[model samples]
Target: MKAKTQRLYLVLGALVALGGAGALAFSTLGDKATYFYAPSDLAGKAAPVEAIRLGGMVEKGSLVKTGETVRFVVTDNVETRQVTYTGILPDLFREGQGVIAEGHIDPASGVFTAETVLAKHDEKYMPPEVAGAMRKVEGKVS
Candidate 1:
């Protein structure tokens, strides 16, 4: 092959390799991604199958504890979602406070069975995801 033809083939091969690598990276990352949603966002839609983070305020008078399992309602003012966790909760977890629960919603019952529950550490601290979600809800209301 001529020198010019060899150079053309090399460039094409390099492009193909780069495209393949990009595709692989995106696919791997997509599987690991966990999406965030507020209670209102889930209204009127089927619960998702994959793991996700649900962010909202713990509704007052909605918490119920039974042995190691605890259940509560998370609300975005317009909608509510029930969350159940089977482990010790964070010290800051309380009613009328912000929380983010990581888990999957049960398709049969439409309840979120949380694997982990996170609460705001202090009066001035709120998770960015929860803050953003609350802002979105407020924008809709106003």
Candidate 2:
């Protein structure tokens, strides 16, 4: 083949390889992506079947524990949702504290079944999503 023909084939091959790599990257990342939502966001909306991160403050007087299982209500003041977790909770986890629960919501009951519960590491620390929601609430209140 001529040099020009050979160069054209090489360019086409590189483009095809790059496109294939891009497609593969997107396909793998799609499954790993998790969405974050607040309690109010779920209201009047169909519960998502896939795993998601729920961020809000743990409602006061809503925590209940039975053996290894624990249930609590998360709220953004405007809305609330129940969450059930069956594992050792973080030492910082407490009622009236900001938290992010990672798990799937049960569509039938509208209850979040969290596989992992994340709480603030310190008094001043809050998850970004939780903080943003709180700011939005404060903005409306004032």
lDDT, each prediction: 0.95, 0.94
Model 2 regions lying over 4 Å from their true place: 2-5, 137-142
lDDT value, residue 33 of candidate 2: 91
Tens-place lDDT digits, model 1, residues 1-142 = 9999999999999999999999999999999999999999899899999999999999999999999999999998889999999999999999999999999999999999999999999999988998888899899999
For each candidate, what TM-score against the reference?
0.84, 0.87
**Candidate 2 lDDT tens digits, 44-81:** 99998889999999999999999999999999888899
Candidate 1 collision pairs: none
Question: What shift in Å separates residue 30 of candidate 1 from its native position after superposition?
Answer: 0.3
Span of 10 residues, lowest total lDDT, candidate 1: 125-134
- Report the error of model 2 at residue 61, Å: 1.8
Instruction: Write down the RMSD of all candidates, one decimal each.
Output: 2.2, 1.9
The clash number for model 1 is 0
